[model samples]
Target chain A: MSFDIALWLVQDGVTNGAIYALLALAMLLVFAVTRVIFVPQGEFISYAALSLALLQAGRLPGVVYVLVGGGLVAAALDIALALREKAPARLPRIVALYVLVPCVMAALAWWAAPRSVGLPLQVLIVLGLVVPLGPILYRVAYQPLASASVLVLFIISMAAHYALTGLGLVFFGGEGLRSEAFSDARFKLAVLDITAQSLWVVGASFVLMFALRLFFEKTFYGKALRATAVNRIGARLVGIPAELSGSLSFLLAAFIGAVSGILISPITTIYYDTGFLIGLKGFVGAIVGGMGSYPLAVAGSIGIGLLEAFSSFWASAFKETIVFTIIIPVLLWRSLRSRHIEDEEE
Target chain B: MKHRLFTALALAGSMAAGSAYAEITIGVSLGSTGPGASLGIHYKNAYQLMPKTLGGEPVKYIIIDDASDPTNAAKNARKLVSEDKVDALMGSNGVPSAIQMAQVAAEAKTPMMVLTPAILSPAVAHWSFIVPQTTELMMGAIAEQMKAKGIKTVGYIGFSDTWGDLVLKATEFHAQAAGYKVVTNERYARADTSVTGQVLKIIAANPDAVIVGGSGTGGALPHVALVEKGYKKPIYHNHGTVNAEFIKVGGKAVEGAVAVTGPLIVPEELAANFPTKAMSLDFTRRYEASFGAGSRNGFAGYAYDGYLLLNAAVPEALKKAKPGTPEFREALRGALENVKNLVGTHGVYNMSAANHNGLDERARVPVQVQNGTWKLMK
Candidate 1:
């Protein structure tokens, strides 16, 4: 309680919290658009990281090479996914998801072999691709499957996430993969004794989140997305192209997921199963913010990050058990209070 | 008729050419994935790269995927032993993993080279002989050394899994015996992001020092966090804690952290006259050439020695056995006592049935990270 572990907490937490927040946003966005809570967002994150790592380590070009690779891979995955949903409307959303996620990953693994793009940047590139990749799959592959069933979409995402984990085991050979962003670039801030990498991660994460919020709030498409989320049928009647809005939501979520992976790469080693942990916590953040509140989700993530920091600072041993237990009461209190307010209004 | 016969003869010649070289089949069950798989890779490379054809005899290895699960290890070991009918077994790396596999080996009466640190215990020789240093024994040395240094307190961290649990208990046991106060600083999943909070609590305790048992990018965050927070007490790290990759991730913050790694990274003066020293060096060189990397971790050292130990015993047992006699078990048991001063990447291993782990204080070269590299301790 006494120690100002906040400096350590903030530096470490923000970088990590940013990653989880973005990944969680992808999960929430997909749910908001298609009404499916995908479990496999982390799988895409793992693939992006591994592919980038292989690319950086070998004969592949610099960041540009990795970026082009990420783009081509995402686009091709999107196209291939688009083709697979021949009867996107006729077949269940689950069916379309099953067909597309594995195919994209298979392609990723093939490219990653015989090259390594150094681990950290690779994770960022992979995450970058994941954001774009989600939209591509939704727009192309499920063209006919629009607004079918949120439940089915959620199931599809879950399968994709699980599939991504298995693929990670196959490709990365089961060891922790990490990147060194600080040394990769170096500029000193006077008297701070920190590297360009740490500064970039911090600055970049805050900037990215701000940009995403702007994109969501300021743009016309952003309004359409909000309309679609709030009242899909009403928005459709008003000529909002709710279908397009849904796809855009998936895209926006993907961007957050990408940022999450990219920003956190320097702090933690990216593992195949890493997503499930981050994904679960991030979704919790989303929930704590009230399922529909964007600002709440962002705030919740930061709060969770702080709580984790404090827990670590105090209960260092068995803190996970304690924090998770505490979460139950926190969640219950929020739920009871929300219900009480609604009761009074009624 | 001549043309017909020549063509027929040519066809027969071609078929003969295809059949001339006999195919050799062997098993290669290991941790193909997971935290410790990296070590399995290096060890497998060394064993596989060994001149399989000594005096024109052929050898073949087919890796059975164990997945690091105990039951899976047993199944895969049995599968390799019976279905694949592998001539030899090498590459299982955990005590539980190896022992589970050993049940199958013992039942099959097949000789298997045990590689995992858990298998290096005294109890392991009952089923399979171990060539690596027992992790428990290594911790013993580490604790004794720490105690001798008048280190009154220690910060303890572990991965919180079965393997990590064992190490923590072992470390606590040994450290306590030497009269060192060990505080439980942190235990989190291998994928956890921030350990600063845990690191902060440890720092606040103002213990004489901290000891981190987990190694990897995930495990390293605590070490890196401590360094960033300016915690400068002697940081005693577990084996496998310091590697080129670890330094790359943690950066200069982990510089001067203490660890007891395998002897391979140590300056080559400890085993001046061991017979296996030259051969082990060649093996290490060949491994680096094959994998395009080098690790000073005990995983490589133990795995390589484990295989050589297995191979050394195999011939002696085979020589005493009746040709085609299913007496490979008895022969192997006898060969265990004779393993002596075999130089391995980590240390000189002189395994006896009573002491399957040949590593001693001399075998363990204590080192610390200096300027992003592992520098040997004086």
Candidate 2:
């Protein structure tokens, strides 16, 4: 309507879009490196937010238990396989990462939860409790099905999403939680008032994105991950261990998800199942990018956020439908532009 | 081995006594683990605090979790009626799920005490009696307050579900009589994280005040957005939004937010002469004691009132036939239709052939969020 109102809407859209962009990048990274859709990526966001909320309240978060449980399961699976293959050397690494790390994190949470640790420590502890869940989930649910078709992997991803959502409910309870804002600063930009929390979201998102770019460009492990994404078997033949690439990608995705959760929790109320819809919106942005290009996916996610903001203003009731509908035309255009190719597995 | 034999003997003795005096079973289906779990869990908790007997008869409550899905609620209702042979049914915190249970109750000719206010079809209405106050009755309190404050226009934002539609219709219905215009009718999904776009549109219209039609923690989103955007006008909420979780989620932004909810939430603020004041106080004391302080909610009160309604009608139904019989169910339905001046935690219910939710203006009280708690607005 008014110029000032339009400007406010744009600010809101961009702030939300920033978070979605982070999620899109994670989805893209996981999908490329592992051939898994990573449907449970949003669960990590909810887990982190709820975990942080609990930490702030000086209560031990249920995510500590999930981390430990997932880690033990992964360790057991790894041990069973190692023994079967007579690869006893692999046992120590599995024990360290799967058994020791989660146990240490859980111990840290148990000790610090009741001390009313300051917000910074709480956030660090939350990151410690939630980040490892990514690799654990990859090892437990995805690695075994590494060579499975995309459809099968997608199905497994959905199952993981449901399982995590249920566990979130059991852990977080039914009430939605909103954490304290990172900052209380508010400034007027023209006629629009900008919240410091939004600035934090946008700033942090860009930093993570730039950091990801740097990592992919400058690091040897990043190059290996890139090679695996380009061709898993070829990278394996060239001595890039597929499992290492998969786990590394998942670790990065989990870190991004946790950071996004911490940034956005102050701006909006997040329930146990809230991440699924947010993740789906990110998937929409990924689809718009043809699920391949990083820069396009970021642009597409920001566009989605802007579109959602405007659509809600125009037709609030049909906002979600309007947002999800964009994927159809984008899919059509991509299908028309790209040449047909044989199935990769075939 | 000796303990097992003694337990078997005690069970056999109780089974013999059970054959002599039939047990009254009430099947309850609630959304204890899904989107509506926040409210449903409270309803479930109320059952734990309820009396063990109904109208001098030993009663059994079979509680089932429907996961907040309407289809599952209907299935639970059917199973309870057929397999458990429940004489009557009670359920469900969400309106959609409650309506599904009402359908099964109507089909099976079993009397049901729905925990949520639902606008049932005439056939379903015959078998289902609503426990909570109707939307019209609850929203009318807001309209009265608006008119008294001389507010001329209001913006509306609510969930895009049956509850939202009902609240909007009620707001509009009262707007005509209250002499105010409703400028907007925006809706958001229950699981939505933000309402910035909707709040911006409402701000552009810039009504004198705003009313949110959402329930549970979801209701806090629009109110928080409105406050963050510097809308200083008062924000009103329906009965559904008046809970500790709403205040907890909305935080300081909802400091001046107002809502009309059951008098059960603020029992101490009710006048001593109020009909349900004593019952409300007692229920609040026991509820908070069991669930911990500041956990008092209106949803749980609805469940307790449902039990009260059934407690009052079961005696009359028992005079006609034995428990676990279809004839007894018909009698219970008949008795429920004639219940009068029965006091419960929320209000004194007076069910009739036409009005199932028999609450009046006395059932609601205006409350404002002050210092992060709901205080009665005198």
Candidate 3:
């Protein structure tokens, strides 16, 4: 390939890599705090994109229904717990999470969905509809089995992926939807024309990454979440509510997923099940980063993106095979380099 | 035990008599709830618009969701044949599932109509009738269009499936015969989100035109990527993308794309003397009347043609045998094979013992996506 084409490929890879990096960061955060693989993280991305598509098409998105249903179920579970513990003091919070938030969102969606809404408002509505789904999903599916083994959680995560995929089909139908680009402006950068959407994706990803770093390092809730991730039992003993940390982490993952979905939707036609593969790519990035280090995950994601882009240029047919095969060598090197530790009994 | 055996025999006799006298049933197995749902839903809507009866007898349709799975299609076909005792069968939004349904129909001695275009051998053709134009038939139109445009070199990007393989092979054969060299061939999964790398490679090859061989909305991915990358070459798509869903998903990116499609895609706009024009307009009217304005799709037209083919043959078959028997089904299959000069929505089908599709250049047309509408090429 020519130098200019090579430079373009790198740019394309980095743009995709930025989305993967966000997904990877979300995966790490969810896994660290909740010990769940967050398989349905990609579903959130699809839902967000589809919701936006529906809004643009002048149709009310089904996300409002899902949010209300999920919130109701989660709230019911919380209510049952609160009544069981005789902790009526938590009833208002439970109601707020379950009844009030979903109702308000649903009401806002019902009102705003019919009128002519701008892109910015539509995007925010999509994000609002999708972000709460993460914690609600955790509460409905994972929180009950919070103390279960990682293997069990993994299986449940897979089940959740299937459920969410089916729900996506119900919500968005089978056809893929593509939204209008955030910006159509193309800047001529010497030999390549860089799209404004690419710049938006890269810019948003970096901003979100830095913002996440600041949140984790500076905020009190972030420190509590960090404590919970460091040692769940110790965090509980030290009065850090592990459950709150779990929900907070999922909320962060949801935000990342929703943002990634909105950013990438314009670049590609996203189907109901598109998020699963994209999320898997992010998971691969997380695995490459050893699931702990943020910088390494970001680097690994860029490597993966570049490899996929270059491999497609070389052998478009086997590009997926090549991208997936990268996991093997990285896994081997990590295993060879790392020391084995015995399992700890909680 | 003897009394129970007698009761069972009596029950079996009654059931046999009951089915033999019931309304003629056409079992349809389609990918109504999966990846194929987008096209399948249109097929379903078209079938719904079909007449309720043929030859003064009630017709029943047993629609089964194949979920875009070949196994499910086969199983559904079997169930429709054995349990439902359907006189005929129709399916399936894809080639693989259609092939499966054809296998079952052959074994059961029932006539089966496939929605998607497929290569039908004499053996499969005996029991199966394809509604859509075959790849070779459509490729001739695409090649003719390219030749007229003075296209010398073409790049190919298609789905990594049987449909893609068929389109690519046909394009290679026809485009080369027309003196156009296929400079590059790239394959991607139907569910792929991006085709940038494939587009880049094709652009690097610097072909005069690019042919994307994918169906439904998936076909739009490569072309969109090409447009986004500022590739100014003409884009061509196969007959598989002759649907509204593709145009809706593709948006402005595919505005100037030329595609091979069946004549029924723009039936009303054809010349007044066109053979299938009136029939196509009729189907379009009924379809649009029910589905709202501009809801008529070429995929649905294929299903409507299937119904017309069956409508013309069922009366002839009814003369030889009753509607709910194996002999009736066999006669129906034979009558369908003999159907000639019958105008349907898509084309004037001329089914013969040798040719199941029964379409010539009359069925194939070149259409350009002009101003977000399918404009028939002169």
Candidate 4:
């Protein structure tokens, strides 16, 4: 490739890398906190983009219903738990958090969805519709099986992914939808021209990553989540609520996924099942990063994105196979270097 | 014991009557949901326009949703044969699904009309009948057009599956014959959200024209990417872009692009003496009458042709053997194989024992995207 063409490919790679990096960070965060790999992370991303597309088209999105439906189910679970524990005080908080908040959000969204509003409101509507779904899903599926084996949790995660994919089809029809670009302006970079959307995707992902770092390093809730990740039983004994950490981690992952969806939606069409493949790419990054380290995952994800771009340039037919193939050597290297540990008897 | 005897007598009587006046059930397993639904919906709507009675027998259509899954398509085909007792099978969409159903048709010794383009050899063509023009016909048109336009070099981008392989192979064959050099080849998954890397590589190669081999809304991505990247070369697409959703999703990016599709997509633009004009317009009139104005696409034409093929062949099969029997199905298959000069929505079919598709140049017509609508280019 010529120098200018190579430069353009790098820009494309970096743009995709930014999105993958955000997903990788989310995967790392969830795995670290919950000890469960969140597989439906990309579905939230797709839902975010699809919700915005609906909002922009002056139609109320189906995600509002998903949110309320999830909220109602989670509220029922909380109410049942409260009754069993004889903790009447927990019922009011659960009602306010799950029932009242989601209902109000849904009502407000319905009012605003039909209006020909600007892009900012449209984006917020998408985020509002997508972010809360993570925790609600956690409450409905993961919370009940908290003490299960990792393999069991993994299976449940896969089931939830399939369920979410089906629901994605129902919520957003089979036709792929692309949103209007946040910005379409292009700037000349020496020999190559780069669109403002690429810059926005890269800038937004990094900003979100920095914000996440601040949350984990500086905030009390973040530290509690970290502690829970470090030692689940010890943290529970020391008054760190494990469930709160789990929910918070999913909430953060949802935010990351939703933002990435919005960023990438303009560049390409978003479909119901699109997120699964994208999330799988991010999972590769997570594995390369040892599945827990944030910075390593970020770096690994960017490398993957670049490798994918180059591979597509070189042999487009085998690009996916090439990208996925990177994990094999990394996995082998890890397995060969590390000793296998036996699980304790239940 | 008396009740059992009466039930047996009733079943025997019904069986005798069924042979005399058969209810010919045609089972359709289509992708009514998932990504294939856009085209599948059109086929489903077109099937509604079929006459209830054909060949002096009540025709029953048992349509099921395959969800674009090949496994489901095979299962649905098996169910239609064994449980529903359908005499013939037709599928609504996707090549992989059609290929799977073709295997079921062969095993059950039933005739199957496939609505999508698939690579069927003479062996597979024994049981399967392709409705859409093969990839070779469309790519040949594109290559001829490119050569006529004095385009010397081209770039290729397509799905990374059998669909892609077929299109690529077709392009390579035709382009080479036209003495055109293929500068670059790119592939991506159907659900991919970006084609920047592929588009960039294609641009770097700097060919005179680009041909994208993808279906439905997903096909529009590369066009958008090309436009955004400021590549001004002519763009050509496969027959898969004949649907309304491609135009809707593509918008300005797809404008000025050339495509090859069934004549039914732009019947009004066809010449008065075109072989498919009279029948294609008939289909358009009936389809729009029910589905509303301008509701027809090439996908609907494939399904309509499937119905027409059966309508002609079933009556001839009835002359040979009675319906609701294995002899009748074998006769139907035989009749379908020998169909000659039967005009349908897409083309004039002349099915021989060897050629199941039975369509020549009449089945395909060149078209261009103009002012957000398909305009006949030929």
Clashing pairs in 2: none
TM-score, candidate number 4: 0.92
**Model 2: how far residue B143 lies from native, Å:** 1.0
Per-residue lDDT tens digits for candidate 3, residues A52-129, read 888888888888888999999999999999999999999999999888998888787777887868899989888888
| Residue B308's lDDT in candidate 1 | 61
- Give the per-residue lDDT of model 4 (tens digit) for A1-346: 7887778778888888888889998887887677788899989888988887778778888888889999999999999999999999898899988988788878878988878879998788788788989899999999998778778888889999989988887777777777878886989879878789989999998888898889879999989988987778888899988789889988988888999988888888888888888898888988887776889998888888888888887888889899999999999998898887533223
Residue pairs in clash, model 4: none
Q: Can you give the TM-score per candidate against the true fold?
A: 0.77, 0.97, 0.93, 0.92
lDDT of each: 0.63, 0.91, 0.87, 0.85
Q: Score the docking of each candidate (DockQ).
A: 0.45, 0.74, 0.57, 0.56
| Candidate 4 Cα misplacement greater than 4 A, ranges | A84-89, A341-346, B1-21, B33-38, B48-51, B176-179, B271-296
Q: Which candidate ranks first by TM-score, i.e. highest?
A: 2
Tens digits of per-residue lDDT for model 1 on B134-192?
66766776787788789888887777565566667767878758888787647766778
How well does candidate 3 reproduce the true complex, by DockQ? 0.57
Candidate whose lDDT is highest: 2
Candidate 2 residue A38 Cα shift, in angstroms, is 1.3
TM-score-superior candidate, 1 or 3: 3
RMSD of 4: 3.9
